[model samples]
Target: MTYDPTFDQTRLDQLADQCLADNTGTGKVIFLSDDEDNRLELTSWRFEDEEAKARLMKSDFKLYLLELLDTLLVYRAQHKQPNASRGVVSVCKNQMTVQWVSRAEAERLRDL
Candidate 1:
């Protein structure tokens, strides 16, 4: 997972597309509820000040999140075990943590 705060607005959309493709071959999807993004949303409101722009930016963030959620669903589906364990491809807030989900899958994705 690469994290660059300097990314342009299209970054989230690109992530979304990747998720859609990855999930198609992966597994079943269940969308979890949103968490404490309200505070983050408020902070965003403080930064942009304009509701319209903030709403658009917020939507983009959600699109990326939905993509990630779908990817999780697909990856879980590939597992043979019925008892599912939740995992995440999360980049820490400090952007320093990376826990590889699968070595083979990572390698395969890298080849692409």
Candidate 2:
């Protein structure tokens, strides 16, 4: 059996905005747990903050943003963007972190 509870896209977007306001990128993961035995593995990607910022300020950033936008559009098409019904359930944990290039992209991940 599988269960998935959608999250509030607006909240995710707001979180992303907060991160951007701090000049940072962010990501989120939703853990669905009830009574189950399971294990999860997550792979991470990282970059030097200063270098990433420098790159984002260049012409290439447009292409990068476009790609991200395309992805978000696809996600929205597949599943309607969630409403503000669910609050974020978890914060950064286990020394793991996420960073998003844009708030819209983060909203796309709200239900995942």
- How high is the CA lDDT of each candidate model? 0.32, 0.32
For 23-109, candidate 2 gives per-residue lDDT tens digits of: 442233322111122111111222335453443345343243333334333343345434211112222311222232233443444
Q: Candidate 1 local accuracy as lDDT?
A: 0.32
- Which regions of candidate 2 deviate over 4 angstroms? 1-58, 82-112
The residue pairs found clashing in candidate 1 are 27-74
Clashing pairs in 2: 26-99, 26-100
Model 1 lDDT tens row, 1-112: 3433233224434564543332212111112222222111101111213443334345554455545444433343444322112222332221211132343443343344
lDDT of 1 at 103: 34
The numbered model that scores best in TM-score is 1
Off by over 4 Å in 1: 1-59, 81-112
Supply the TM-score for candidate 1.
Answer: 0.27
